[model samples]
Target: MTTRARNVISAAIVAGLLLPAAPALAQSDEQQRIRKLEAEVSALQRRVFPGGDGRYFEPEIGGTSQGTTVTAGTPSTTALTDILARLDAMEASLQTLTGQVEVNANTLQGLTTRMAALEQSGAAPTLASAPTPTPTPAASSPSQASTTTANNLTAMTGGASSQPARPAPAASGPSSQRLAAVQAIAKPKTDDAGDDEYSYGFRLWDAGYYPEAQQQLTLFVEQYPDHWRATYGRNLLGRAYLDDGKAREAAPWFLNNYQADRNAARSPDSLLYLAESMIALRDTDRACIALAEFGETYPAVAAGRLQSQYEANRAKVTCTN
Candidate 1:
């Protein structure tokens, strides 16, 4: 009886232990399979999204109270790249427009300055007044009595036939007195109507009354075309236009001054102003040529401020050797 009982008891204990081990082994196997499936899913996600380890999830169609449907999506690389390219293009366009606007503004400013200058110079004369010609006096015959007396006297003196003395020939050129008078009128110390017109105009120019100065200078040139100071007047007139930002208009005047009288008092100055006007107009090639011509024409004039101005302008234009 004791052997049978011991065998049965041992069998029951072994059966219980075996039953618990089977369930535990099955659970472990199921967990390992689940882990393997998770690893595969992670690898698939990496392949699909490449940028991150997070899985992509579609928006759930939650219960809708209304008929409208809502949807959302992540921005794709291609769409984002297109948007960036558009933004870059817009920036470039904006930069180009800004540059053009700046150029236009500069041009407008120059034009305004030129207009102001033109207004200041007074209206140009339509026609210069010509000098009035002097009338020659008619020759008068000697009185009859004087002639008879001369004849009688000649007869008494037993002289040959007397002939009326020819009037002395008029003197040639201006007299010393006339020249002195001109000088006095041209450079008077007081501010009188008889003062030198050229000096008065030059003073006005120096004082920045460009319009009035130009008018006075023009009148002087018109009234005294043969005067030596006419050349200076022309030069100053051109300078007035140039200083007022009317370079294009100034250029023609300067050219005319140099062309009309190459040996005039301010011919070299006219050429220099011409070069400056060309530079202002952005004609660097012409400006350089003009400067070179000035050097050739007035090489001796290279000592004063003129030479320094030439060098500075040349550098500004980036002139070639």
Candidate 2:
């Protein structure tokens, strides 16, 4: 009637089957009983467990003194019956697993045999394998659509939220070359003279020359070691690497800023860039720590305002056992 009853019947039949003195007629009767028991177990398992994952289970306490009542389909009553059945005849677990493994092995053997036959027949030679697919990088950042969407998201979601400081765009491209040819790199300006090189970088960045900008920014740092713009130069180079989908490349540049001169005006921006780089690299441990440090180091700065956001993000991070 129920799953447990069927399991008990099967075990009883198995015991009877093992009896050496049992007669042939009695043995046939025992086999019929076992079949009947297995059928009952299957039915009860379907009704109680119902699905692959939602299997029946029994609590620590055994069934009622009056014998466990199966209230048709109540979760506790019927499910308990199913669970007790499964637990009682633990051999069923091994049988089920073995059946599945046997089926799979047979199928695989058949497939292998067929394949070998075909290859010998020369109907489908070289069917053993093909080259695996190599993954290319995902789409690069700084596309018009991507920029617009990111800007929109930043504006809308973070109106009340703190805006993380961003490094300037990449500044190495054809424009930088034009600027180099037209203007002195030393007297860089927006209006005239070295304006060409200065403007060239921005244009190259706008044209998506992220790798080029990374190189130019490195050069800029060398040329203007004492200038205030040197800080921004390194910052932009890091961003260029980020835009080019190179998180590791960007990380060191940002980290350099994090440890730059404490008295400098760009120190806050430097820390901000470092944190951003860490986040991009998915190095949450370091990123959160960096943000917390940012909060302490620049207590009143806008970049320091990112403390709450970083903590909130940290709340969602978890280490699995």
Candidate 3:
């Protein structure tokens, strides 16, 4: 009935009405935020999985999709193990293939070298017996002996007529002396027999006894396979054979020396001799190849100590380059 009581009652009634409607406004705002979030998630799914079949969350336990069930069992663990095993197997196979590739590359390189040799050998000359060494004067004709006697008589007269010239010494005298000198060389008996034997062989070869030189050098090489002088022995053996008119047999030895160790001291010598042997065998094509290889491989040696020999062999054959 009073104004103050009436105002208090009106304020209570207004508070009660606003308090009931506040919860409904809050609920409406919450629903709008959830819808906005759902729209944003849908847009993200479209960008991430254009196929439109992707799940935003993992499948529920024991749920089935594509006929395979998600479960608490060990199926996933087994699949992971299988994938790791496959990866390891693939790695091992890759290593094996890599090793095989290396082997193939080496084989290919060897084949290429052989092919090049074959190509160069296409027009090679046929092998022939090496020419024999020239005979000494003991086998001279009667006319030659008469000429020699006249030359001796003229030397004794000193350009004036003289009393009858004395008969010349027997031809056997010089031959016997040479034989005795060669026989006196004797095999080496010292501790450094390899060096001694090589020296012996060299002397024999220089003295024109190629068979004896070949024998000594062969023994030297066989007995001292690892000796430093082995390269020299091998090369000398080839030369002895070549000098003996056995070019067919000599060529392989020279080639072996060059191929065995290209860095050996006697390697260049062997190559030059190999070319010589090939030329002696009438295989001028291979001879040229060997000479070319010598120039390319040992330019310094080809231009130095072996220059004369190299040029002489090159002149025997016609090379393209």
Candidate 4:
């Protein structure tokens, strides 16, 4: 009885000891597996996230994370879509800007070509380099004080007027009115040697500026009745009217010029323009009369070329009378 009881008691104690060891061993294995998994996850984050800010975690605070961490490996399709949309918008803007740049380039090229053509055509002389003039002598007995004053002025200027350019008087475009004003001031002065009526007018209306030319020419003719260049002035006036798209106004002007200077070389030219205007007005009979008159008056002139052209054109014109 004693031996049997002793063996049973030993067996029971050993079983109890084995049961406690099994639980502890299992806990140790679980802890080791968790450490290995943690290390692997840290290595993966360093490779994939780059300082924990690849659209995910940010820097760590003292004890706990500041913002809620989104679960890793979840595809943020919304953020990627937003980035693609912004890129598309930028591309579209770039295309529009490129189109505008091309249009501007074409406009600039056209402007440059036109400017070059205008420059090549002879224009008014540039005012940049004025000629140096010789000094003028004063009357005899010119005192030293007077000479000094003159020299001082000469030193101040290179013998040119430094007076402020008189502001051009305002006008509502150069019309007959402006011509009238100048004619009033310059009429009796026409006989004066210093009078520069014709030249003044020419300067104002130069470069084929027809309307301005006509206004200046009118002033010159109004001021001087039988002056040497009076007929020349009238001829220019007619040509100016033609350039200004005033054919009817120009017709009488040419006739007046031709009548005033019958022997002038410009007589045939004035007659030709007059005929052209008459034809434009549908007065073919008068135009032919003018043409015949020009042919008889000046048979050999540069303007005679216009007469032949007119005859050829008349062949096609429908005559009213």
Clashes of each: 3, 3, 0, 0
For candidate 3, give the lDDT. Answer: 0.65
Q: TM-score of model 4 relative to the true fold?
A: 0.36
- Least well predicted 10-residue stretch by lDDT in candidate 1: 157-166
Model 2 misplacement above 4 A: 1-199, 303-321
Across 69-121, the per-residue lDDT of candidate 4 in tens digits comes to: 33444254754675689899999999999999999999999977765443222
Task: Give the Cα lDDT of each candidate.
Answer: 0.59, 0.52, 0.65, 0.55
Off by over 4 Å in 3: 1-181, 186-189
Q: What's the lDDT for residue 136 in model 1? A: 26
> In candidate 3, what are the lDDT values of residues 1-321, reduced to their tens digit?
999999999999999999989988997786667667655655664565354442332222332333333333234455467668989999999999999999999999997777545323211111122323332222124422344432432232124332112123345544777779889776555556667777678777767877677777787777886776777778878878878897866766676666566676677787788788778878766776677767877788778667877888898888887
TM-score of every candidate: 0.39, 0.36, 0.44, 0.36
Q: What ordering of candidates by TM-score runs from best to worst?
A: 3, 1, 4, 2
**Residue 249 of model 3, lDDT score:** 66
Candidate 1 ranges beyond 4 A from true positions: 1-195, 303-305
Measured with C-alpha atoms, the lDDT of residue 67 in candidate 1 is: 29
Report how far residue 195 has shifted in candidate 4, in Å.
8.6
Candidate 2, residues 43-128: lDDT per residue as tens digits?
A: 66666556634345321222344434333323667667866787878888888999999999999999988865642221122222
Please write out the lDDT profile of model 1 over residues 1-321, one tens digit for every residue. 699999999999999889989977997786667667655655664566565522242323222344223233344565467668989999999999999999999999997776545323422212222323332222122421234432332232123222211112345755787546434433335432322676677666665656555667667766776665566667777787777676765666666566555566566777777778878888876676667666766676644436666677677776684
Structure candidate 2, residue pairs in collision: 175-200, 179-196, 179-197
Candidate 4, residue 2: Cα displacement in angstroms equals 99
